[model samples]
Target: MTPRTPAPGSVTEATCTRCQILKPAAAFYANPLTRKGLHSRCIECMKDVGALRREVPKTTAAEATCNVCGWLKPSSEFHVNRRRFNGLTNRCRACAQDYYQAKRRGIIEYQRQHRWEDARVRMASDARRRDRKHGRESDIKAKDIVIPRACPVTGKPIYHGYGVRMAWSPCLERIDKSKGFVKGNWRVVSWEAVEASGWQLTRT
Candidate 1:
């Protein structure tokens, strides 16, 4: 369609609908169908809109708001989610971890109170449950597991069993899973001892 011709001496300048500023007609892109022979938005505003359409927020590596905790954090703190435009989870790392643990085991809040010691205790107990489900003999009681406030060896606080660092948290070690959860078969020990002995302690 051909653009409508402006009335005599009525087309010197036009108002940009977006920026609401009067600019020379040259500031707009030519549009054959518009009454003024140009787009409603000026060139600069149009360029910004175009860039927004093509941009990928997830690939930008900038700060983002976490939907769960309502905190603005670095992009790296979020887990990748294929469904989101930014390719990141709506929750930050810490919030996501809590949500995941709560959803799976429903003890995230309770475990957090003890610095996650309860989590280790539950892990060992869960093994016993699994053994019972599989019809394997398990004498372990969930209430029987004990978590010491400090490591018996190093006398350091036993926070949680995480990471491979020198001060890694304490862990539950089963002397023998084959023997089941019998009274003398398990103990809570520091991760350092387990690592030093080169023994991979199974959860059960």
Candidate 2:
């Protein structure tokens, strides 16, 4: 006579050699080789086997090398916690810095020569657009202040293009507040006159 299989709702006891306990048949794995009976090992043992199957051999520092500069660097230089590209940087630190500096200089020179006018127009349009979008007052204001007619100190005809109003003079280090070098006070002077006046330029 053939043996009857356990019913779905009924429980069958099975012994685990590892845990040394008599557990329900559900706690062990089904083994076709043992007449479809529960295996001697429990579910926890199967999980440990699965973990061993998925583990990889760790690479040592001797196996790692920098892609750029062809240097055999330590594995510590690369981060292993990353999930992509075997956790390695494409370029070494020195090579990466050189690449960035070259790219930056190229961009700066190109923008300085080619994009000044277009950039200025775009910036003005963007400011106006932002003001309209947010319903805020635009800060663009007109300056109607008069240009100094004569060199206040030198008493000479200050060249329109070479003097203060024409050329840009950065703010000085020390302001002569008592001598009226405050707001709404400006004067045109020659470079020699400025030097003779002993005014020091701010380092910025």
Candidate 3:
């Protein structure tokens, strides 16, 4: 038999397939792909079904399949997820690690490519890291540091960028390596001045 199609904007009522009861169309969730443009089951029935599915324990053997890589591996290879009855993630450890590493590399590359846009932020971050690494009670404030328009030593205009080599970029220098990144202990100096002073910037 052909299904009765309700006129548009007049679907005030529908039937829940799960509960086998007539109910308001608003009780069902919208589903554009369905014929009626609404779920056959009411929202309450759907919620009950979801709760039942969550309660049902998943069966797992000593080996499990990684949903991502489609590879069968030992259950120990997956991370634990309390929500799952099997207590293991669908993705194996190797696949999860690879995914995270790729995500991290992409972020690093993005930051490196946009370094010029965030030079001042990077300078402050570096200072804070240095302070923490040295166990110093000093703080680095972006507002406190003044970037000079020109190199203090050479009287040349200062430049800031990611691709700009250290020899031409603005650099944060510590007057004394033993000192922390305190207000009086650090200075914004050109990389050329640092090299002229026989000091090389240390890689963190």
Top TM-score hit = 3
Pairs of colliding residues, candidate 1? 58-86
lDDT per residue as tens, model 1, 1-204: 233345577566789888899988767777867777788888888889888777665464477799877889987898776556777778899997887787867566555656454565675667577667656666765566677888776677776635443555656566776765557877777777677656644642
- How far residue 152's Cα lies from its native spot in candidate 2, in Å, is 22
| 65-128 per-residue lDDT for model 3 (tens digits) | 9999999899889887757767678889999999999999999888764664477777888888
C-alpha TM-score for every candidate? 0.34, 0.28, 0.40
Q: Candidate 1 at 30: error in angstroms?
A: 57
Q: After superposing candidate 3 on the true structure, give the runs of residues whose Cα lies further than 4 Å from its correct spot.
A: 1-16, 19-47, 53-61, 84-87, 117-189, 192-204
Compared to the true structure, candidate 2 yields what TM-score? Answer: 0.28
Residue 178 lDDT (model 3): 71
lDDT of 2 by residue, 60-160 (tens): 33335666678877665654533333445666566677888999999878865444334334434543454456564444212312224355555554333
lDDT of each: 0.69, 0.50, 0.76
For each of the candidates, give the backbone clash count. 1, 0, 0
**The 10-residue segment with the lowest total lDDT in model 2:** 165-174
Q: Candidates sorted by lDDT, descending order?
A: 3, 1, 2
